[model samples]
Target: MDETRQRIQLVRLLYVSRAVGPQTTAVTDSILSVAQSANRQRGITGVLCQGQGLYLQVLEGERGVINALYNRITQDRRHQDVQLLLLEEISQRRYADWAMAHVLLADDDPMVQLHHPEFDPYSAPGASVLKMVADLVAKGERIRKTSV
Candidate 1:
């Protein structure tokens, strides 16, 4: 059997949390732990978005492995009204080894702000960000630029 090169399993999840007011530290802790655990269980590694009660994530790895975890993420109890925004295979893996990495946009993480639409990570939207994100990920650089 030929060794298969890793394929990035990318997915976007738009989820609304049940919590009211601001998200708590305890909640963030649990969520982070879950991300790491998922990495161990499924060999997935990528970025996550958690803000304003929404959780968006990108997972990459062997196709079978990532798809399995993607299925599980959709059914996870932590999120309600889960809608899969996007799911597609990309040519390469984004992270070197994350198991899963996350950036909390809601809590004002500089990095998240930079990447978020409002922050304008690429100075403007469109194809530039797409290429820039790919480059950053390929270089194992976390997309967390400060915006101020």
Candidate 2:
């Protein structure tokens, strides 16, 4: 098959980074605003979890687009020590509903304690981090529904 006719593979990428400054509402809001606009245009979906000066994000999209986004994120001045935790080809997106979903975690969030006691993304295994993100997303959805 020709290159154009070949199927493009989808992928899910997870990464962790530390905020260069405080993890304030304005900072995260700006990041989300930009990301949502860009990601929607690029056909990407993902969830961003921020807390305690750390950012744990999972991006899902075509391989090249996802890779390019990751590259840009690593160079973004707002984030430091960006570490890619997982990158794998996938048949479907886990976060298809949101172009960029934001979950602001608190140090004492019960879900965090239930999923991972220490809740340190830097030291946690890739699979564990992914699981935590999934749980958080589910929890967010539940909260949104109840509040609606």
Candidate 3:
């Protein structure tokens, strides 16, 4: 085992039932609405990526808020195959300034490889991308980073 192995993050996740089709503009809009309300309600900061029939969300906030969100998300008709990637409290909020943020994960981006893990959907790139997205959300750079 790597004695120094450590990667810390905050997160919340859910899989989408009504998968957003290839054209995601409309779906992203709908999800932003939900994410905006949720972020305000819980004082959370994070991003929601809709793609390949899934919603990959990463939220950072109080532990209780995030937990309650997970409970609610699992029951939402729009979600399925829900699995948590990371759920630890951080020293500071990651998405502190955003009401909500959305991203369309292009199929070929290095981040897209994260959708399926070593089988658990909880390993490797999925985990890495979760952290990456959280940081991107917190930093308010998601759009600029993807701009052509």
State which candidate has the highest lDDT: 2
Best-performing candidate as measured by TM-score: 2
lDDT over C-alpha atoms for residue 62 of model 3: 61
Give lDDT per model, in order. Answer: 0.52, 0.84, 0.57
Question: What is the descending TM-score order?
Answer: 2, 3, 1
Candidate 2 scores a C-alpha RMSD against the true structure in Å of 3.3
In candidate 2, stretches whose alpha carbon ends up further than 4 angstroms from where it belongs are: 3-5, 141-148
**Per-residue alpha-carbon lDDT of model 3 for 81-105, expressed as tens digits?**
6666666557775556666567655
Residue 70 error, candidate 2, Å: 0.5
lDDT of 2 by residue, 1-148 (tens): 7996598899999999998989888888788788888888898998888887889999999999999999999999999999999999899888887888888778788877765778788888999889988888887742211010
TM-score of 1: 0.57
Q: Rank the candidates by lDDT, best first.
A: 2, 3, 1
lDDT of 1 at 13: 22
* Better by lDDT, candidate 3 or 1: 3
- Residue 85, model 2: Cα distance from true site in angstroms: 0.4
Compared with the true structure, what per-residue lDDT tens digits does model 1 show for residues 1-148? 4345443444322222333345676886676776677566665666655566655556566667766766676677776655444445666555645665655544454444555546332243334434433444444433342111
Ten-residue stretch with the least lDDT total in model 1: 11-20
Clashes within 3 Å, all models in order: 1, 0, 0
